[model samples]
Target: MGPAGEVLWDVALPASPSRLPGATMAGFADRGRTPAGLRLIPPPAVTLALVFGPGTVVLSGAAGRGSVVAGLGFGTTRVRQAADFSCVQVRLPPAVAGAVLGVRPAELGGAFVALDDLWGRDAARLAERLSETSSWDERFALTDAVLARRAEAGPAADPEVAWAWRRLVRTRGLVRVERLASEVGWSRKRLWSRFQAQIGLPPKRAARLVRFDHAVHRLVAGQEAAFVAADAGYADQSHLHRDVRAFTGITPATVAGEPFLTVDDVAWPSSR
Candidate 1:
């Protein structure tokens, strides 16, 4: 339990390896920490996260409301809060890149932005009401409604950006940005601009996040650290250590061994 009396769900990812082909596995987290100021927690890896319930609002530290609800990238971190209730969170696969970052799951590496910017006041209220409902069917209906609105409001897709994103995932971050730009036939600046507009972050940052996410999945599933590091494209164990520290504020070894709430936690899996 946290400082507040609210209970927390024992979050876990799906156990099936067959479901994940190029990215980390997805998980669900239901937490009711407190209705206080936002609390920032480092994820196990870079991922697209969804705030699926009411009362909760994710805030960005650097960009404030402007950065709160977007599909943030790998190194980005945000403060999370629930005004008077709890919230549910769902993780997205790394391969599933977002198209527009302002409100939809189509954005890649978008930062946390304001809920109002994405869902608006009415949608937010609907989510709040749905959170109090007991039936899964009701919840699903509410979710569908919200998704429909989001789809309607989402930004148009750019084939070039989509193609580049696909290539990046297929190559697992081994491909260079310049090569991607050339393949898309867009100037480097043009590519970056389009990517930022649609994905919230540049392609390189998204790629790194995806790469780190892959490494974390392997580590969590009992893979050897050294081998996982190599496969993830690190120069060596030390390079992997640096990458983790840069994004998560911890070394790979510490993360390999523990359940870390923040990047600073020791790298060990949870005792349970």
Candidate 2:
């Protein structure tokens, strides 16, 4: 472990099933040793990770260029190609995460696709350079450049969708979709379409993710089940358990007393 405690969220990629022709698969693992505490990572995910000890080079799988390191938040999705066989992972802030996906953190409930949709060849080259960097500062600078470009190239999010997002954040998972639509002067159908376009997922799904995110935060911070359930807007403790399992595939007890470390948890800090 680094400055933090033991690597709490270590998960290896599972083997792919045979019989699929030339199947390409990807997964991510987070080490809990970094100085950053619990993170709120969201979905429609994008990440490529490799672990290198302190003062080592980090590189992607291919020999590309123009790589950058970015910190993203929950509810942003992008395609990530891993660099370096092993390297320290970093946490992402919501803004950067939104920039990468060409959407805001408030809009992330769709499936992940290729980076080409957003970055084209530049993304591939960046992956290569990310794998080759020696200094973390250089990596971070490159990441900043990438984020800047993404911010420039990415489309502006819908004002109404953003408005709904602000309300969701404020409620801490207690707001309703009808209220959101009325506040934004949109029909439910119109709101869903606009929200999906800007944020990848529909409002209901986003709300669920947000609610689950809050529950995880409560667990990580060691709140009692009763309080966590109520504060997170669950119907009750059992409701919280059901939702937690749906997203994380684990029980609240499994994560209790430990800082929550799911991708969703890492992307949505406010929920935490």
Candidate 3:
């Protein structure tokens, strides 16, 4: 809680996003004395969390105060270390993730990869630069500039695949694959193949994840599970239960109290 007793997490956003055609960001800090367990919930996009500060952020059992990337999938990752780190996290939609990350999102295979693995020395240098930076605004600017440059220089998603992914996102994953394939003038097999190749997950899996993301947030907002299931397009409360467990390895009640989703509105904002 903040000084005023509001639901507060020391998180900030850019004054205005200069780039990020389909991305959102947040600046996060934790200062509890005890070690913190941050259960990262995967959204519908690729995530990059850049860490730089007095303490460490341990992901996938490796302690790195640098940066880590989380590709799209149903996996549970916890931060294991002192709870005194500041991080700038960015979530990029498939349309921009491939270009910004400079590789097919499929290459990540729903796992955690240190930024050094992909960007090498550049990642170290960026961490140092961010640590030296004094203001959150400057930090956001530096991160955004690098992403824009990378997007301009790197590979791009196929136009058809990009369109299909966007459709899934816009519809909250409620649209059918056949509808997308027909709209793109491609057979279902071809669309599935290309989307998996570029976006990192097959069409059905990606849609399920997207739908889960939408439903999870509603749960976090304090809605009853039965009501959320009906409203979120799940076939039944049991279906919602299965998805929540499959994605986070926890029940809906536990998910409702998670700090990751609790801080989402302030950190991520609902616009994008």
Q: Is candidate 2 or candidate 3 better by TM-score?
A: 3
Which runs in model 1 stand beyond 4 Å of their true positions?
1-70, 74-86, 90-111, 257-272
Best by lDDT: 3
CA lDDT scores, all candidates in order:
0.50, 0.50, 0.83
- Cand. 3 TM to true fold: 0.94
Model 3 per-residue lDDT tens digits across residues 167-259:
999998889999999999999999999999999999998999999999999987878999989987899999999998988999999888777
Q: Write the residue-wise lDDT of candidate 2 on 1-272 in tens digits.
A: 12244543343222322121111112223342323223223422233232333222222222232223332122222223322233323333232346545655444323333344445676666656765876555554555555556656666666787678657756865788998999999998899888766655577876787677667766866688888898777889999888766665568876554333533243233223
Backbone clashes under 3 angstroms, per model: 24, 35, 0
Q: Rank the candidates by lDDT, best first.
A: 3, 1, 2
lDDT of 1 by residue, 1-272 (tens): 23332333334332322122223322234454433432343342223333444344445453322113335443435444444333333233222323222343434234454545544665457555655767544554554444445434555447787687668767876788899999999998999888666555577876776677667656756688799888989889787777677776666655554333322212112211
TM-score of each: 0.64, 0.61, 0.94
Lowest summed lDDT window (length 10), candidate 3: 1-10
